[model samples]
Target: MDYQTLIVAVDGKVATVTLNRPDVRNAFNETTIAEITQVFRELGQNADVRTIVLAANGPAFCAGADLNWMKKMAGYTHEENRADAAQLAEMLHTIYTCPKPVVAKVQGDCYAGGMGLVAACDIAVAVEATNFCLSEVKLGLIPATISPYVILATGENAARRYFLTAERFSAQEAHRTGFVHQVVAADALDATVADIVKALVANSPNAVKEAKRLVQDVAGQPLTAELIADTAERIADIRSSEEGKEGVRSFLEKRKPNWLN
Candidate 1:
C-alpha cells in the first residue's frame, strides 16, 4: 500500500520503515498512526522480510502527536477521543507484537508517542546526541497508549521518574535504562544498525520469530508447573521441526545453514 507519512524500503532480508514527516519533526497524526500500523502488518507477513528497522528522516526522530492533530482533538467529544486513542494503541501493539524483530535507529530527539515507537521495538540503537522524553504530562496529557511498551522497556522505577517529570534524558541514560540497546556516534548509526540486521538475518528466520514470540508470551508471567511444561513442550517442538533439525545438522557438519544461503 502507498504511504504519505512513511518511506518503506527493503534490502535483502531487512526492511526499513522510516517516518518521513521531517517537516513536522515526524510527529504523528491519526493518518500517520494508521499508515504505520498497516505498513508493519504487511511487512510482518512478508516472508522475505526477516527484520524491520524503525527509522526517521529528520533531525528529530519524532515529537509525538502533531500540533494540528492535537488542536483537532481538543474539540473532540469524549467518545471520539477514545476512538482516536484506540487507533494509536493498536498501532503501538502491532509493532510490539510483530513476528519479526524490530530495531529502532534513533538519531535525534524522540518524545511522547515517539517514545512509544522506540519502546515497542525489540532492539534499539541511538546516536549519542539523541534525546528521549516522555513529555506527555507537560502538555496535560498522559503517556497512556505507549505505557505498556514504555514501562516494559524503561522499567517501573524509571517510568515513575520520567513520566512524572517529563524531563529530557540523554541517549546514554536511555541505554542505561535499557530502553536503547546500543549507543553510538551519529556517523556510526547506519553501520551499527546494519550489523544487528546482519546477525538477525543470519539466524533461522522461523527460530528468530519464535524467539521473539517466546519472550513476549512468557514475560511477566509467574513461574508455574504449567508454564514450565509449556516451555519444555515448545523447545521440543522446535527441536523436532525441519528448521531446527537442519540448523543442528548444518552446525555439526560445519556448513552454513540453508537460511544463511
Candidate 2:
C-alpha cells in the first residue's frame, strides 16, 4: 500500500518503516497515525517480513502531534476528541501486538506522543545523546492514550515522576528506567541496532513471535495455578510442534536448522 507519511522498504527478511515527515520532525497527524496503523498491520502478516525496524528521517525521532493537527483538535468537541484519541491508541496497539518483533531505532529527540511509539516496540535502542520527555502536562494535556504502553515500559514510580514533572530525560535515564533496552553512542547506534536485528532473525521465527506474546501475556499477572497451567500448556504446544522437533533434531544432528538453511 502507498503511504504519504512513511517509507516502507523490505530487505530480505527485514522490513524498515521510517517516519518520513522530516519537515515536521515526523510528527503525527491523523494521516500519519492512520498510515502507521495500516502499515504495521500489513507487515505483521507478511510472511516475507520477519522483523521490523521503526526509524525516523529527521533531527527528532518524533515530536508528538503535529502543530496543524493540534490546531484542528483545539476546535474539537469532547466526543470528537475521544474519537481522535482512539485512533492514536489503536495505532500504538498495532505496533505493540504485532506478530513480528519490532525494534525501534531511536536516533534523536523522542518527545510526547513519539515516546509512545518507542514504548510500543518490542525492543528499543537509542543514541546516547537522544532526549525523551512526556511533555503533555505542560500543554495542560495528559499523555492518556499512550499511558498503557508507556506505563508498562516504565513502571509506575518512573511514570509518576515523569508524568507529573513532564521533564526532559536523557537516553541514560530512559535506559535506567527500563524504557529503552540499550543506549549507544551516536556513531554506534546503527551498528548496535543491526546486531540486535541479526540476533532476532537468527531465532526460530515462530518461537520469537510466541516469546514476545508470552511476555505480553504473562507480565504483571499473579503467579496463580491457572497462570502456571497456561504456561505449561503453551510450552507443551510449542514443544510438540514441527519447529520445536526440528530445532531439537538439528542440534543433536550437528546441522543447521531448516530455518537457518
Candidate 3:
C-alpha cells in the first residue's frame, strides 16, 4: 500500500515498515498513525509476511507526537479530543495484537508516544547510543493512551519514577526496565535485527502464533487443575498433528527442520 508518512518493503518473509518523516525525527501525526494502523492490518493479511520490523529513516526512531498537532488539539472540545485519542489508541492496539510478530529496530532517541510504539512490538532491539524517555509530563501532559502498553513493558515501580521524572535513560537501562530486548552498536543494528529475524523465521508459524496466543491467554490467570488439563490436551493434539510429527521426525533424523530447510 502507498503511504505518505511511511514506507513498506517486503523482502522474502520479512516486511519492513519504516517511518519516513525524518525532518521531524519521524514524529507521529494523525496521518502517520492512521497509515501505520492501515499498514499493519494489510501486512497481517499477507501470507508471505512472517515477521515485521519497524524502523525509521532518520537520526531518531521517533520523537513521539507532533508538537504542532498537539498544539492544535489543545483547543478541541472534550468529545473531539476523545475521538482523536481513540484513533491513536486503536492504532497502538492494532500493532500490539498483530498476529505476525512485530520487532522494533530503534536507532536513537525514543520519547513519549514513541515509547508506546516500542512497547507494542513483540520484541525490540536498540542501538547502544539510543536514549529513551516518557516525557509527556515535561509538557504538562499525561501519557494516557500509551499507559497500558508501557506499564506492560515496564512495571509500575519503574513507570512511577520515569513517568514523573521524564528523565532520559540509556539503552541498557531501557533493557533493564524491560523496554528493550537487546542493545548493540549502532553499526550492527541491522545485523542484530537480521539475526533475530532469522531465529524467528526458523520456528513453525503455527507454533509461534499459538505461543503468542498462549501468553495472552494465560496472563494473570490462575493455574487451576482444569487449566492444566486443558493445556495438556491442547499440546497432545498438536503433538499428533502433521507439523508436530514432522518436527519430531526431523529432530530424530538429525536433519534441519522444515522451516529451516
Candidate 4:
C-alpha cells in the first residue's frame, strides 16, 4: 500500500514499517498517526508477516508532534482537542496490542510522543548516542495518553522522574530503566536489530503470537483460582494445537519444525 508518510517493506516473514517523514524528523501529525494505525492493523492481520520492526529515517526516530500540527491544535475547542488526542492515544494502543511481536529499531534520538512509540514495542534496540526525553511537562502539558505504555516500559519510578523532570537522558539511561532492551553503537544498530528479528522469525509463529497475547492478558492480574485456571486453559489449548504437536514431534525426532520449512 502507498503511504505519504511511511515506507513499508516486507522481506520473507519480517515486515518493516519505517517512518518516512524525515523532513519533519518523522514527527506525528494527524496523517502520520492515521497511517501508522492503518499499517499496523493490516500487518497484524497478515499471515505472511511473522514479526514487525518499527524504524525511522534521518537523524531522529520521531520528534513527537509536528510544529504545524501543534499550531493547528492550539485553536481547537476542548472537544476538538480531546478528539485529536484520542487519535494519538488509539494509535499508540494499536501498536501496543499488535499480535505480532514489534521490535523498535530506534536508530536516533527519540522525544516527547516518540517515547510512546518505543514503549509500545515488545522490544527496543537503540543507538548508544540516542537521547530520550519526555518534555510534555515543559510545555505545560502532560504525557496523558502515552502514560500507560510508558509507565509499563520504564516502571513507575522512572516515569515519575522523566515525566516530571523532562530531562534528556542517554540511551544507557533508557536501557537501565528498561525502556530499551539494548543500546549499541550506530554502526552496530542494524546488525543488532537484524539479529533480534532473525531470532523472532525462527520461532513458531503461533507460539510467538500466543506468547505476546499471554503477556498482555496475564500481566497485572491477581493470582487466584480464576487466573490460574485461565493460564492452564491457554497452555492446554496451545499444546493440543497442530503447531504445538508438530513442535514436539520435531524436537523428539531431531529435526526442524514444519513451520521453518
Model 3 gets an lDDT of 0.91
lDDT of 4 by residue, 1-261 (tens): 799999999999999999999999989899999999999999999999999999999999999999999999999999999999999999999999999999999999899999999999999999999999999999999999999999999999999999999999999999999999999999999999999999999999999999999998998899999999999999999999999999999999999999998
Query: How many clashes does the backbone of model 4 have?
Result: 0
lDDT of 2 by residue, 196-234 (tens): 999988889999989999999999999999999999999
Each candidate structure's count of clashing pairs: 0, 0, 0, 0
Poorest 10 consecutive residues by lDDT, candidate 4:
213-222
Model 3 — TM-score against the truth? 0.94
Misplaced by over 4 Å in model 3 are: none
lDDT by residue for model 3 over 141-221, one digit each (tens)?
A: 899999999988888889999999999999999889888899999999999999999988888777777777777677768
Candidate 2 at residue 127, lDDT? 95
Query: TM-score for every candidate vs. truth?
Result: 0.98, 0.99, 0.94, 0.99
Worst 10 residues of 3 by lDDT: 211-220
Better of 1 and 4 by lDDT: 4
Residue 217, candidate 1: Cα error in Å is 1.4
Which residues of candidate 1, in runs, are more than 4 Å off?
A: none
Q: Count steric clashes of candidate 3.
A: 0
Each candidate's root-mean-square deviation in Å?
A: 0.8, 0.7, 1.6, 0.7
Alpha-carbon shift of residue 218 in model 3 (angstroms): 2.0
By lDDT, the better pick of 1 and 3 is 1
